[model samples]
Target: MSIDRRRFLCRGAALSAGLLLAPGWRAWAQSAPMLDPAARQARAVRYVEQASAAQDDPAYRAGRRCANCDFFSAGQRCSLFPEHRVSPDGWCMSWTSE
Candidate 1:
């Protein structure tokens, strides 16, 4: 299949406009987790023993973090642990940098 430049631009513009007009977009964007240390711990976030920790798992790395991981969203919430704010600098066993 082939796509024309004008058609692509129009579709992109429409999508952008749709997102901008969506009433829930603002609320959804603002609803990202706060990533509090205590709350995270209570939720079993394992912030101290993350993949970035010293002497952590073999797949762990020094600078890898949740903000850059595929499982994270909006630099706060995590797909693996929904409704909770995760540290952008935090890591976990499921961390996957992407």
Candidate 2:
């Protein structure tokens, strides 16, 4: 087999691009698991699966929920908890309207 500079450069570029995109591709192809209220990250933010369950918290507001939070994505992923998907009706102290 003969090695060529052009072919080597092209292969290197393709490999680099694939490596860079692999994580994003995996993220897009798989749905994140639902957030568990008992999880440490969830507990840290005082997350509740249902907004109503957060009533005891001073930060809870009548109409605030994950679906309407600024950090929430349409796919139910919360920026604060990137590895999990939260319930649309979930509430957390980190919730923000901005």
Best by lDDT: 2
Tens-digit per-residue lDDT, 7-47, candidate 1: 99999999999988676754775577555545645346445
TM-score of each: 0.53, 0.69
For candidate 2, lDDT tens digit of each residue in 1-98? 99799999999999999999988866763577998999998999999999999998998989999999999876688889887889999999998985
- Lowest summed lDDT window (length 10), candidate 2: 23-32
Worst 10 residues of 1 by lDDT: 45-54
Candidate 1 colliding pairs: none
lDDT at position 41, candidate 2: 87
Whole-model Cα lDDT per candidate? Answer: 0.66, 0.89
TM-score of 1: 0.53
